[model samples]
Target: MNRHLLYAALDAAERGWAVLPLRPGDKRPALHGEDVCPGIGDCAGGHRKWEERATIDPDRIHRAWGDLPFNVGIATGPSGLVVVDLDMPKRKSSTDTPNGVTTFTALCERAGQAVPATRTVRTASGGVHLYFTAPSGVRLCNTAGRLGKRIDTRAWGGYIVAPGSLTPMGAYAVVNDLPPAPLPEWLSARLTARQASRALMTAPSAVRASRYAAAGLNAETASVRHAPEGERNATLLRAARALGRFIAWGDLPREQVEEALQWAGEQAGLSPRSCEATIRSGLNWSIARNGQRRVA
Candidate 1:
């Protein structure tokens, strides 16, 4: 019902930014939307496929904001935008920034480059969101401090709470008037490396996935490999246990280990939620057991 917010959403959409509505003052979607979310978050928008319904049409935007005051959510990936979210320190110190700044600074140093001044947003939490144009064929995933502690990337599958959105805490506001700059090659390489690492780590399982069909393995292996709902968690946990042992010995990145387990789970038809929870629980148990053994 707030015309100001409505116009803000419309203006963003006009600039080819795919937009969606968020619950008033909250980060979650305003409604149960389509399975369009590429952003990885712990809780689903409405606990299910919420981003699928995000849109750029002014008419749909109107309908969304007509009922209650809503926050503007910009879909990053769909619009070819990537945002570097930097959680700046609350205490104003020229040299003091969150770990993200340090990480980014190190990255720039290694790459012989400096961070570009791009379309920037000042978040309610006193953080900054640096917008960039995503490169073609780059599978940029939403990360929580993966790039650097407290630094994250929101790309083709992620969304950013837009400026002019208000929360009880504060509001998001645009500080820079520039358009999103092209993603620097160095940063692109880092994001691409993440995808590459995932793919490489899962390559063996992917091959096994192919073997599961046609020339499939015997019953026990097949059952574990291609798990169904009831047996899914146990099967994945067993696998995660192995991965955790490997990881404990410095044999793998936990992310890739997770991908390997999910790769098998999907082959067996487990949902995303099922895959995540099973892997998390299994990995924790594995780590704990390993720790106890060392202590003993």
Candidate 2:
């Protein structure tokens, strides 16, 4: 690896945000060793391996740059960084290279929208890491997982592709400075409207599961109860719709659910319509039983 390039990347990263360097073998560099510094490490000396060497002063960087835009890190090579969307279905064996690359590209495109400044760095695994400068205060969640399952990206020990992490590969550093398009103002508004509609229509359905559970009915019993005609059909339809909505928007934080619903409503150009009260009630009950708070 090019030590000079690594130093330069660390220096550039220090100019904006703090960086945590990962040695070739270390996994949890931050948690391990005696060294509490962000940049330097002593992995070669086992006894003194974790001794803190030095740390980049965030205050000093801020004073020098006057409010830098992002935080970043550098990896020795492409293998150092890995990309996983955690949205894709997992395979029983072998890696899904095509699908993985597609998802990675999509994430890069999305990041490009928020931070116009982006650079692509190659990984040792022959994959690419898309680097971008994240805007202030925007943090990413659920990043270390497969496109659908729990894919741990930390195994590679490179930069994360989320909003807060910087994109760096091997000796090369990707810098994104161009401004991307802003999200539409009406998006959140539309989601709010849809949420309101769903709230009203699904009110009754929300409590259905709770009602069954209250009556000492297990899942099997509840299924039998809904086997009848008329009300049963409506109940099934409501359940399906509610589940679909959840699947479509469940990844968003609960706080953002209302806004997302409103946005969906606007994009579809449809008036918000609530699902049946039975469905809402059943969903509520299910959520409660699962020890989860309902977002919509």
Candidate 3:
């Protein structure tokens, strides 16, 4: 692997927040297990290769940035970062064409409008990474929770995009000599608020405790009954956001629910088959555990 590309990815992630690099060796605190690339190429080689399996330590990335506010990173190749925008659209298949490209294009267009100097385009992997020169006088947040915790853009090593992994065509970018995108004050505030909301949702311990209290159940019982439901509900809401909807769960139509669930599954890195099972299980669990109970 070209260390330059790796550093480039790292630098990109650093623009958004502080990042920890996970490579083949060198273990200060090691992440658990070998990363499973899934349908992407093998990232185990430490260099870019075919598009079947790319691997990075998700646990480590999560852990490293868990408490920090709003950190994001790249997961595959020397130049990719994991971008978690609640605004990102959800789809059924990771390899689904047009959808990925369309989303990428849309994001780039928005970014261009937001910061004209930061022009971006699509990558072959169907994933888009927006690039910009380091802006002067702007100190980007390096922690994980600053940008509404809902959006994460960090460069850890496990995520795989196209051409580099699953897509045969590979990733492509629209290059322009553009200045770094300026972070708008209003946008930054909104993102920060969103991150705060995300923190509440992902805070497992706090959520479990709250559920137990609300359901009048003990911790152990709540662990099984309430906790998973809470998680499932949050996941579903995330799905809805990815699908670009603003309605509450009860307000969503069945078809929309199905589409959102599929998109959520893709974000979770689940296969199409797994996504189906997950959606079914989540819905069933919700009904069984909270019959006639409304989810706020």
Candidate 4:
């Protein structure tokens, strides 16, 4: 009995949150220790961890929504909470200001104290999550630019999307009433200085992985993460101008090769509002408008 995912996983396990199931309209994991993927190329690595069968147990979420119309998720560190997603960008500039509502209103003016209006949700592309709580020991990891440019931060193995869920791109509602915010000791020292500047940019430096393997671009980054779609934006502008000719030969780090060519142009689908302006205009048309034709 789905009943809106069995009363939304028993109202997110009566607000202690943990839930799980997902896979109605879709967000993967509709159970399968035995079988249930009647599609999606029959799962496998396509996705199925269901975060080790997440649960707050209202009778195991009523036998996991009695196997019907699923989608609910919400696990976030055994429910200690910590979401803050905020996505929203499809190309701003109607006078800007919407980087997830101006980075949660500049972290409530630098955590002089504010975040108390939580349990927000909304997302279905327009983006927004909010929630909070986990800050005790502080380890809040899972990040993709934690506080800017389409911000993200989902703590400890993460999981969300559960406000009465539904998806084929729509329906995650809760939109804030309040309850869940707490992590702000100056936003936990600005997320521990953004986790030490992302561990000093992924701790590599054997001369930046030998100049990022001399930008040979391993088969054009596996064809820019499987390009196709009528040559996915000219194969992601030819792999961001061969990662800007390995960052104009100083060998790399134009913000980590434009965050790995915008995560390979979002695994070749692009459209996250022009994936960071198509990798910053194909990395300034190959390092500043064809830097003297990158010297033969």
- Scored by lDDT, the top model is 1
* Predicted structure 2: lDDT: 0.33
Model 2: CA > 4 A from native: 5-9, 30-55, 58-97, 104-117, 142-296
Q: Scored by CA lDDT, what does every candidate get?
A: 0.69, 0.33, 0.35, 0.67
Predicted candidate 3 versus true structure: per-residue lDDT over 1-296, tens digit per residue: 33333433344444443333333222111223223333323244443321122223444334443442221223322333233222223455355433433543455466563323353435443444444333233322222223322233322222322111112344334454353454444444444554344333323333223332323212222232222322544554333333222112233333434443443333333333444555556555544553343557
Candidate 4 worst ten-residue window by lDDT: 33-42
What's the C-alpha lDDT at position 277 in model 4? 72
Model 2: how far residue 55 lies from native, Å:
4.9
Model 2, C-alpha of 188: deviation from truth (Å)? 12
Candidate 4 wrongly placed segments (more than 4 Å): 6-68, 72-83, 86-113, 121-128, 131-143, 146-160, 164-241, 251-253, 256-296
- lDDT per residue, candidate 4, 181-288, as tens digits? 787677668877756654454343437556344335444555776865557778877777766766665566577666555555554544334556777787787787
Report the C-alpha lDDT of model 2 over 1-296, residue by residue, as the tens digit: 23332444355454442344433322223224333323333344442321132235544324322333233343211222222222233355447544444654464465452322234443333344443333233222112222212222221123332222223332323334333222222322332343354334322233223342223212222442334322443433344334333323332222232323322222221211222233334445444454444567
The CA root-mean-square deviation of candidate 2, after full C-alpha superposition on the true structure, stands at 16.6
Best by TM-score: 1
At residue 169, give the lDDT of candidate 2: 30
lDDT of 1 by residue, 187-227 (tens): 88887876566455424333223332212212223455666
